[model samples]
Target: MGKQMFSKPPIQKSHELLLPTTKESCWILVFLLAFGVSSIHGDDGKIDFRYHHYLDLSRVLNDTAASCHEISRVYSVGKSVEGRDLWVIEFSDNPGVHEPGEPEFRYVGNMHGNEAVGREILVYLVQYLCSGYQAGDARIRRLIDQTRIHIMPSMNPDGFERAATLGPDSPRTSTSWGSYGRLNSERIDLNRNFPDMLPVWLLQEESQRRNHHVEIPEWYWDTLVAPETLSVILWSLSQPFVLAGSLHGGSVVVSYPFDSCGLRKVMRSYSEAPDDALFRKLAKVYVDGHRKMGKCGQVEPCNARNFTCKGGMTNGAEWYCVPGGMQDFSYLVTNCLEMTFELSCDKYPGEDELQTYWEDNKEALLSYMEAVHTGIKGFVRDGSGKGVANATISVEGVDHDVTTGELNIFDIKTYFLIPQRLTETTGDCSFRGLTG
Candidate 1:
């Protein structure tokens, strides 16, 4: 006999307590139950899960790691102001500490509290890669062997918890600092708090009353001097790995280079310094990938004519003219290639679409990752076989990776452009480029 499909509910009407079973009926019930539970868990009228529910995610990651010991490990990068551990899960096939010379990659999610899906995507990717790789999945194994993936699931744990605990339908008008969800308890926009690349002076009585000692908001002052941003800066500066992508949401877009205003000025001139072609190439890859995913948005250059620069605050690294943005900073300061990937649409899509987004982005992300592993090395040469001077080269694409162990921010490589000057000659000038 085939398996029975329907079991009577505990409470039934007197008229009909018994019913015939059917396989289709059983399948329907199972589907409904699964869908209902997922919807409930992903409730609050948004596809994103509540931030405090990260504990459940942690458990899921732990279970997957235990089952597939070689491909994944859960670790902490730091602690939030609220003292919650900033969890980072490393996914790679290489089971030991990466040798000094090995390539690495970093993928960070949830830098902002409201953009929570990245954490889910990171977790899902880890599980998928581990399971897929163990099954002799060619693509998975290749990615694992070639690159190391360092994923920070939640950069702003405090903000995430606050947003989630507040519920999705909560009033947008809430005035609490946490309700705004951009800053910590101290109300500093981490993105804006970086050292200002171009500082504007505000002349006030305090400005005229300079003193050796002054009382100020300690948290504000301390954050202005915080070592956290500096630590990430130092870490990325010390590595030679390929690409890094800082993931965000609210719009499906991939942004590249010179996020701060001064850098834009430097890049505007044809002779002084031009835009990097490598960045353009990567942007193309991202745009193509998104288009393939049915998301038809162009990859916008960071320094486009219409790009916004005014009112932009620089981080510490940016202020010292350090190009200290996570992506631009990695590229300009360290010469490591990086891009800011804004994942998903402006209004949050439903949870049902999450898997689809991942699938669509897989190839583009993988291609970019591969580009980083094999450094995109090239030389611009003139017609006379001599190197071209002041010629800019940019390469852009989806960035992905696998890591050996403890994927440190410092370990990821930056995309670099080595400009060499060619002596002036009489022959008609032409240029050439190459990548490994």
Candidate 2:
């Protein structure tokens, strides 16, 4: 089929908050005025359900690093359109420095600011990993020692503030940004604002190859890659990331790549990746760790009648298309295999239900990081048992390959490094290091 103009579905209305059905009062949201708020917190001074506003989140990051400078480092990778710093907390013994042969993984939260659960969970992750390390937890220590993991709690801080500022019972906007803060400052959906791969795939010829970024025309300059998107794009490219999964709200399932088919929207279809099996394994590791995310039989399937994602994992396009999604862009452009995690059914869950979320997802969060070690990762030696630095590693029949670093070790996600055989003798290897 020829290229079709992408007219995606309208934004969902489920993000609006509902009033509590209490006997004392029906929980009427009395908005005295939208403009006058002493602070972003609730009347009690904190949005308790473990949720923190932008200021508090930043404070938590600083405090975490302040308390544990030995194993943690806090820095801003980029800022939002509204000039909010995109804070990233890296957890490692050698936090700021990148060691060769060590693979990196990242978890990004609050891509949609209204989806507050992910943002809160990611903030909590900093405390969980850091305090766990201090407590001499073997698992936490092992993870920190082995992987260079980063948690970006709020990629869209401006949107978060906007969402929190609006509060509940506010009228929804239809044109661009949702009722709350779903989009960035300019009201563009960040998830739908990337250099879409489907167009590049169809346009690129074998002789004139171009990357997802390089292939874009001048017409797509401002809208295609927003400041927030560019911030994450550059930050992600700077690291040798093996995996980068984002936490989104509005559903409860693990969604893998190919978010858009690059064609007109259809009711149902599946879009498989070159490394579908590896993606499945990675998603399963996460879903299985969650107490309820993996069980697909009766009580909680992704969609009871129409679908059955055996292990609570769905291909992004098959489930529903999200054009210009970060997941697809990360995979198609770089070595990182990005996945989209729909963490909750409610875009903005109430505060009282926050602890339940932490308990539900904490184990899954830790286990997903362990997946970076699932594929063949270790040192590559030569014939005489010497470390072979910069040697290309390829498996027969696989299109991609990874090279060993100065440390003589190569670590790669199986998503792109799908090797059927053991040696690089059969074919030429193209992917040298997961670094951009």
Candidate 3:
């Protein structure tokens, strides 16, 4: 709530099956579709930019781990409606352990099955990180050494299978591209399937409106939420995420929370969060890092939409109301600061265009990850030198506050650092995993 400044930096499951059958046998079709079926790497050692089957995705992640075993590991968060594993590849110096004072960052792609760009681009990112670190890229090494990065390339795999057409050679017309793969196997829109908290926020008094870590209602558990949504909820809560990016498609802009404006669905008014300035800065980080996004209407995707923002950034609700969006949920229910990156005008682009997209967004992705290191972080300890648990870390005049200890959905706890400008008057900064 105050602008004060400082210098510098720091930082599973099993299910059984209902396989969808196409005109071609799934296995044979997938193999033929993958251009070079044996390897994902090209002659120059860069990943081939193309659409990949779920099996191909798994292989890419595992192969990366095997090749870069010292700094990476592959794991599954849960299963989808059609029994596909939601795989996550984590990059850290200590791989599986949560290092003290090290922030956890995540990039979740393809929440919508038709939004294939985010999914494939993330695979490119995985390859870039592992290869860059192995090649002794100083910036990449610094990121891997100081921060823990988790990337789930495709969150809705079942929908992706439905959306991705025959192979790289198959024709994708305008009619077929955007319509088929937007939802999950249950026909649920994963983006809108999370619990909505707009009503809850409206009910709270003005002073209590900016409250963080709002609990999920018990009734939410009994609803018809998609399995994919539930999987992400559990995964997001189980870790201490400092910053997150939800990659999407259909337009090119960066959107920050609060995404919904209670009941007034049709109105295009801004719903400013308590940390609005901080959120705007985060969105600008991506916009400025990209080649064309910051130019706004001058770029291809931006011009297509006729969108005009100073830096191709807009508040989520102002752009258009999106209730139950993951971007809003990440901030409301957890300590994570999340934003949505709409990467292209085409939701599902041709395989030929994947390489261009990777080049366009690569810098922005790395810069955003590096941002997790710019904030303040420390522990909340008592006079006895033991860390204090369930403690609230409040800043004067800032409505939103972070808590210390562990993180979980039912009773969530924050990990580290408020990125905003702070002074001594704004007391109480705390961290996670520091108990004696």
Best by TM-score: 3
Q: Estimate each model's TM-score.
A: 0.59, 0.76, 0.83
C-alpha-based local distance difference test score of model 1: 0.45
lDDT score of residue 329 within candidate 2: 74
Give the per-residue lDDT of model 1 (tens digit) for 249-280. Answer: 65455566545454243432221112344455
Per-residue lDDT over 359-382 for candidate 3, one digit per residue giving the tens place of the 0 to 100 score: 778878887887777656665554
Itemize residue pairs with steric clashes in candidate 2.
none
lDDT of 2 at 77: 85
Q: After superposition, how far is residue 28 of candidate 1 from its true place, in Å?
A: 63
Local distance difference test, candidate 3: 0.72
lDDT of 2 at 73: 92
Tell me which of candidates 2 and 3 scores higher on TM-score.
3
Q: All models: lDDT?
A: 0.45, 0.64, 0.72
lDDT of 1 at 220: 30
